[model samples]
Structure formats: structure tokens, C-alpha cells
Target: MNFQNRKQLIVQTVDERGSVDVRELAELLQTSEMTVRRDLVQLAASGLLYRTRGGAMKVSLATDQFRFANKTAVNADRKDYICQLAAQDVQEGDILFMDCGSTVFRLCPFIRNKRITVITNSLPVVAELMSSDVTVNLVGGEVDKERQAVHGLMAEEHIARYRANRAFIGVDGISLQHGLSANSEKEASTATAMARQTEKVYLLCDSSKLETDKYLYFAPLSLFDVLITDTEAKPDVVAAYRKAGIRLIN
Candidate 1:
């Protein structure tokens, strides 16, 4: 393929997969590994893909980051069910904490007029619940445009003041070994603090995240009171969490 055609293909691959493995790229492009590396460098320089250790990642608000919109599309239906199950645990007048994430966003639709107090860092969640009787407080701080979540030291301070009866949170990956993880350290810190402030922590995760590791670690699965997932979840992974004394729900 010509240089222009090859570059387009590389960009397209990363766009579709969110990331591209270098070895796979070389094989697909029928080129040497060195040539693929050169192409990736050019793409990175041109504000296209961001080159990582063994691959290239798509560009987003945070460079090489995934946005909430993209995430909401992944395993959407399963996330909805998990969110539905989470909402059943709420009681009237309960002070709840919801983190900014696609899975948690699903809970907003199910939370009707419960006369509950909700403190959250997610913009979408606040917007969804605006008309409901639920008293929603937006945690103020610098907004993370990509995740559509408010996070930073200022937000963290506000979250520390109130203890929550329950905290519903999500993570980029849920590993039995590594605990919770997110793409950004700031996001992870906000989530970790929210979990600590709550009497009970419920994690909403799709099957895809089970046993997967990410760049930043939030907390171990043992720290969570329960995990709500979908039926597609791997049995072994669920068993691992169950063995750790964590309640797993589908």
C-alpha cells in the first residue's frame, strides 16, 4: 500500500478498536515491525493516534483517553441491568453517593421520586435526575470533559464531609488481584475517596471488566460490599471475588 493509504488504515484500526497492537498492525499492513513503528510515530506526531509501549491508542479529551460516550456504548444493556439491581438497594431519605461512569449513569433512569439525597460527581447523572424529587448535589471541582465527571482536590474535599449510606461506583477494570482501576489517577482518587466515605460500596461492572487490569488501581474487590454484574460474566472471575467474601450479583 502507498504511504497515504497505509496511514489511513492504521488510523481506522485504532478508531474501531480504541487501540492497536503493534505486532498485529505490522502483520495486517504487510510491513516490517520497524516500518510499523515509523508509521505510528508519524501518526502520533500528526495528532492522530498516541503511541503506547506495544500499540497506539485513539485520541480523546485526555490524550489517548476513552470518553464516557464511547464507554456507554460498550456492554450497554448489561450495564443497565446492573444499575437496575443497584437501585433496588436504595431506601427513601437515604444519602447516596454515585460516581461518574456509564454504568452508574444507568441507575439514574431507575431512581424515581424516592426523596433521597444524592451527592455525585457525574454531570450526566445530575442532569438525568434534575426533575425527580431526589435532591441531587453536583460535586464541584474542575470538570473532566472526557468522563463528564467533576474531579480534583476541590471535589475530593467536598466529598470528605458527608458520609454516605451507600456508594454506587464503576471502574475501567475489575480485577480480583488489582481491585478497581480507572484510566486516570485523578478519577481513581475521587472514586476511592467516595468508597471510603460510604458505609456500603456497590460496584457496577459489565462482564468485560472482570479480571482485567488497568493503569491505575483504586481499591481491591474485597473493599467493596457487593458487585453487580451481568450473566455474561466469567464464572471463574466471579468465583474469585466470591471466594474473597465479596457478594456477587447478576
Candidate 2:
């Protein structure tokens, strides 16, 4: 199998069986033990799995809280501040498309009382808005266990069926060169679908993501109606974005 396909299968195997023995993986993949070892090392380095003596294991919450908690803990206050800034633009009776971004999730508490309809793929977003005044439409798809979100073809199709006034999205990285990007195709596709179906798009990104680029570029800076960030953002960086015609609300 190709590296990408092998990688996905490796991750799925760990998710399904809770762990993967090197010999078993090699047999299942029809590759060598060395290939399995190399794959395990790469996955472990990427925080996708825990490397064991002769195999690898799933990255459960207890082990590391996976990427979701680890990412949330990083610049938690900054993320909240960015979200608060984004919340200022929200209006009553608006329909919003929220993505499965930790920063986007923070906007939930601030917008709880607004009579808004939220169309989202985030499990956390749906959970937070469950008892609120906001009406939620969760897209149908496979649950991404680690990210606590729904993704895949069905989710994209569901998102395409609805239109929104505003889409509050997140990015793994952003840059003038590569635009707004995500670490995985599933995330990129979902965000792209939301942006395509929304009238205006708001990017909720922290200062740290400025000028950085990730694996998949889904949208350009021009796609956003406004970029909301925390006050910690550098003046020059904000100026650069504004100069490039990206409206900023920091």
C-alpha cells in the first residue's frame, strides 16, 4: 500500500483493536516488519499513537488526552479571547456554521443566549449548545473519536444542504503564501464545505497561527469576511493581513 493509505490503515487498526503488534501489522499490511516499525515511529512522533516495545497502542485520553485536550491547553486563554472577539459579530436569529475547532468551541459559551441556529460538525460544539437557547443542526457522519467531531462524505453532503449567514471556522495554520490550512483532509473538506455554503466566513485563529502553514490548504485569506484574533497578535502581522485585504477584528 502507499504510505498515505498505510498510515490511515495503521491508525484505524489501532483505533479498532486498541493496539497493534508489529508482526500482526506487517502481516495485515503485507509489508515488512521494518516498514511497520518505521510507520509506528512516524505515527508516534506525530502524537497519533504511543510507541510500545514491539508494537504501538492507541492514544487514549488517559494516556495523553490526544490532540484535542493537548491543543486546547495550549494558549487556552488566548483561544478564549479570540473567540470572545469573534462573538461580538454574532447577531440574534442568525444561522452560524461552526467547525470542529477548539477556538470555535469557545464561542459557544459567549453565544449561549443568542436566538441563533448553529450548523456544526463538532461534537463538543453540539454538547455545549445542547441546553442553550441556540438551535443546533449536527451533520451526519462518522464520529472522529480523537477530535470529537463528525467528518467524511456524509457530513460534507449534509453541510452542502444548508446555507448559513456566517461561518465561524478554525485553522491549523494561516499564511499569505499557503492561505488558511488544516492538518488533515477531513478537516479541510468540512471547512471548505461550510465556507462554500455561508454568506460570510469568520476565521477564529490565535496569534500563534499567524504566518504558519499546515498540510492542506482549503481556503484563501480572501475567503474570510473578518479574521478575529486576540490582542496578543503582533501589530505588524495584523497590519500585513489587513494590507492584504483581510478585514481584522482584534
Candidate 3:
């Protein structure tokens, strides 16, 4: 492979495995170990990855959040279905707050032409809605580059500035006991802020997230006004949220 193709190959490897060793790249690209080292060095210098003892670890984006490329591929069809279900609640002229998550990103296309004002800190959501007539307000703060979402004290402060009719949030996990959790502390903070500013909070999660717990806890099940999930959600999990007075939609 040529130099350019070799570099692209290196990136594709990291995207697939989340990390790659120099020796593996050497074998795969039919290049010398020193040449692979050079490629790794170049990629690391360009902010593509971080070199470790024998390999490179995909640079953990924004400290704790996974890269968008990593997340955009998982449970895509389920996310699309949940988004379509959630969009049914959104009517024209509504002022809503959409939180960051892959599922919420899928809701963007269905939102076109809706006379709504969307306040969000998710860069992907903002980018998807940029050309639409919907008034989009991006709560600015420290950008979590890997997740491409904004969060921190500044983001929370901005979220407090507006009251929304509905807030659509997603979580890494939810359980009968733990409620909702997030993979990153910043995301938990941002989700909490979004939940607080809205009259009603709807947790949009896929079936895979049901009964799952991650690194950070966000809120109790009672906090969410509704839970929108895919049909694959476990019946017991659905019952748990329902028992907490959280309406369930599949």
C-alpha cells in the first residue's frame, strides 16, 4: 500500500478495534516495524490516536465519552424506530430540549418543517437541524470532542436560561433500582440539566439499554415523565418503569 492508503488503513483498524499495535499494523500493511512506528507517530502527532508501549489506544474522546464513529453504528435500526415513535409526541410550534445520544440524533430527519424551537447541547443534533426552519439554540460550553456534545457548568447555566415544553433524553443504562446512568460524568450533568429545564422529561432509550448500568448515575426513574423504547424491551423492565409512574412507549 502507498503511504496515504497505509495511514487510512491504520485509522480503520483503530476504528474497528479501538486500539492497534505497531507490529500488527506492520504485518497487515506489509511494511517494516520502523515504518509502522513512523505511521503511528504521524497519526498520534495529528491527534488521531495516542501511542502506548506497543500500540496506540484510540484517543478517548473528551475524557470519558466514546467517539461518534464508535457510537453511530450500534443499534441503529432500533434507534430509528424509537425516534419515529418519539417524534409523534412533538407537534408544530413546540419548544423542546433534545439531549445528546445516538437515538435522539435519529429524530432529526423527522423534525423537518415542524415549527419548533429546539434547545440542545448535542453538536450532531445541531448539525442535523441546522438547515431546518426550526429555531435551534445550542447551549455552548466545553465541547466533548469525542462525543461531540457540550457540557460543564457553562452548559448547565445556559440550560437554566430557557424553559422547554418537553425534554428528550437518553441514557447508557436504566434499571428498576438505579434509574438512568451515563457513561460519562459530563453527560450525566448535561442530561440532568436538560431534564430540569423541561415541563416533561422523556427518556428515549433502546431495548439494549434496559436494565443496564454504566459508570455514572443520573436520575431516579420517577424523574422521567415517560420512557420511550423499542419493542424488544423486556416486559419486567417495562413494568418497573411503569410502576414508578413513568409512562412506557414501545
Candidate 4:
């Protein structure tokens, strides 16, 4: 397998087994132990795993919340691709609502040229578009240090005052049964509020989030008008989503 595929496999194996030994990974991958060690180091550096003396362990899901910096590193390529597609939905003079989700934050750089107004709660989005031509209006509220975004009743009230032509958001998990969910209630509330004020709701997520449900359910599947994801999304899930009348961009 290629480097990207091999690294993905390593992450999947570690996630499924909770931990993996170097020798076992090397044998399973049909590669040398040196290569396995290198892959483990790379994944560890990305905050996807904890590197050990002779193996690697998956990061503890219970304690490891989705911090902005860490989320940016995970599925970096896929997020970029999804952002590329979502950027096409933007137009000149459009008023957009951007949620604080990591995947939705990727849209900032791609949208710099568009003469649009951005209402956002994300610190990273504000910083990225501050010097660009796009106008940024930050929602006021208490900042969540780990999330690097604004949240709370103040932020939700701020969102309610404005209506946008389109809103781009992200979620920690999405499933047919559980709908859209997030690990933090604050983030979930902010995302839901943004969606409520927009005419069109576009969800920017990677395939990993498909068929998964997190701690809090914020919105239903019908809240989203379009789902922008990478080609890696599961075929069955994509078909099911399409059947449910949600537009899919893969």
C-alpha cells in the first residue's frame, strides 16, 4: 500500500485493537519493522495515537476531546477536499454563517477571494479571514479554550439576530438514527443555531464521521440540505443519505 493508505490502516488497526505491536503491524502490512515504526511515529505526531517503545496505542477517546489543533491534523487531506467542494457553494455578496467545526474551518482559506460576509464563532476562521477581502463578524460569547471557539447563550442569541444565505457547519458524528451530534453541548448548540438561521445548510465532514453518533445530538438529518464529504465515504451510507433526499457531494 501507499504511504497514506498504510497510515490509514495503522490508525484503523490501532483503533480497533486499542493497541498494536510493531512486529505484528509489520507482518500484517507485509512491510518491514522499520517502516512500521516510521508510520507509527507519523501517526503519533498527528495526535492519532500514542507511540510506545515497541508499538502504539490509540488515543483515549474518553479523555481526548476534539480540540481544534488536533482535529485539524486528523483527516487533513479529506477535509481539504471537502472544503474545495463546499467553497463552490459560496458566491459574491453572500452572507454566510460558519460554525466552529474543524472541517468547516477549512473553508476559510478557500473563500478569501469571495466578496462575502462571514458570521462565525470560530477563532481560527476569524483569524484566517481577518486580512482577507471577506468580511468577518465574530459572534460574542465565552470562549471554549479547548475548542478555540465562542459558545454559550450569548453566541446563540447573536446567531439568531442574523440570517444567512448559506451556512456551513460540521459535526463530531452523523448517523441516520442519531442525526448530527457533537461531543460538547456548547459546540452542538452553536452549530444548531447557525443552521436554524440559514436558508441552506451544508455539512462539511469527512467519511470517518459517517454512521457514528457522539455524546450529544444537536440536529436532525433533515436540517442539512447538502452533505459535502470525500470520496472515501462508504458507498452504502452515501446511497442511504441520497435516498433520504440529502444532496451528497463526493
Question: Which stretches in model 4 have alpha-carbon errors above 4 Å?
Answer: 1-64
| Candidate 3, pairs of clashing residues | none
Task: Report backbone clashes per prediction.
Answer: 0, 0, 0, 0
- Give a tens-digit lDDT track for model 4, residues 65-184: 456776676677889999999998799999999998888888888999999999999999999999999999999999888889999999999999999999999987788887888767
CA error at residue 8 for candidate 4, angstroms: 12
Ranking by lDDT: 4, 2, 1, 3
RMSD of 1: 5.3
For model 2 the TM-score comes to 0.74
lDDT of candidate 3 over 48-166, digit per residue (tens): 88876556666763233377755655667888899899899998889999888877878899887798999999999998899998899999899888788889999999999999999
Sorting all predicted structures by TM-score, with the top scorer first, yields 4, 1, 2, 3
lDDT of 1 by residue, 103-197 (tens): 88889888867889999999989988999989998898999886788999999999999899999988877776677877788778888889889
Model 3 misplaced regions, further than 4 Å: 1-65
TM-score of 3: 0.73
lDDT of each: 0.82, 0.85, 0.81, 0.85
What TM-score does candidate 4 get on C-alpha atoms? 0.78
Clashes, model 1? 0
Worst 10 residues of 3 by lDDT: 61-70
Residue 175 miss distance in model 1 (angstroms): 1.6
